[model samples]
Target: MTRDTQGENAPSDLDLTRLLQTLTVESDRYAERFGSRHGLHRTDVNALALILAAARRGEPMSPSALARELGLSPSATTALIDRLEAVGHVERERPSGDRRRVALHVPEAGLEEGRKMFVPLAEAFADSWAGFGPAEREVVARFLDVSTEAMKAVSAEWAPPHESQRRR
Candidate 1:
């Protein structure tokens, strides 16, 4: 086998790292295209995804939580939320139980639009994984979970404290 730049064997950890990097770049490119098509910034698209995911998990996000997740300032997050709300893509609801707390939600139209945009990608992922058996899939899932944790840890380590935290 050919040696890599560090004199390591081909198809080693370095190869896997490069593959993951490529996957990230491609995913970002896809998101960029989607943002462009929908008249949104990349950050806006990311916020929408986070809000949608939180809603799906039955734990809706707040502006502050979104700011932390996006590493954005509280003001910037508010601006983003405003833009999304103006576009009818998101809404801020004050739950009846806690009138002071604001919950972010994607309107039904927004959900439908997102579903239309993502269904093709979801199908592609399913098709790609079709050849993998249960054992292989389990290993893949474990790898993904570990990789996600590692990334999150690194992000947390390097990220500066959010502006909201600075005020408190």
Candidate 2:
């Protein structure tokens, strides 16, 4: 009988919304732990994840491209790449005809370590999805895609990085 300001059910009382929010928080904690275990900073792990994602999509990532995706300056990205290279986590190469572009690559050892860390969780996810038929899985995928875009759009309108944030 009562309507909130939005004239809809409050998100706090929505099971799916709460579950998605909680998953986002828990996933952040998991990512932090995983990064620590791999001797990488959280952002470094995120960069590697992005690189792996691009590779999976058959589009290799370059240092400048990674900088753009990571929201880092060119100098900062170079420093990050240097650290990873020192640790044998990534290799730099000119994969394309553009000699000025530096392609980032995860060596076999790095890939193996990543596999060891993530394979179990990936298998569990796959096993869970195995219970759903193709139609159900498709619906779930579509929902996730829409949810992601909605969140992204909402995020763009949120308080952006101010002077205080930039100082950090």
Residue pairs with colliding backbones in model 1 are none
lDDT tens digits by residue: candidate 1, 22-95:
99999999989888888899999999989988987999799999987888888899999999998889999998
RMSD of 1: 3.0
Q: Give the TM-score of candidate 1.
A: 0.88
TM-score for each prediction?
0.88, 0.81
Question: Could you tell me the TM-score of candidate 2?
Answer: 0.81
**How accurate locally is residue 88 in candidate 1, as Cα lDDT from 0 to 100?**
87
The alpha-carbon lDDT assigned to residue 159 of candidate 1 equals: 66
* Clashes within 3 Å, all models in order: 0, 0
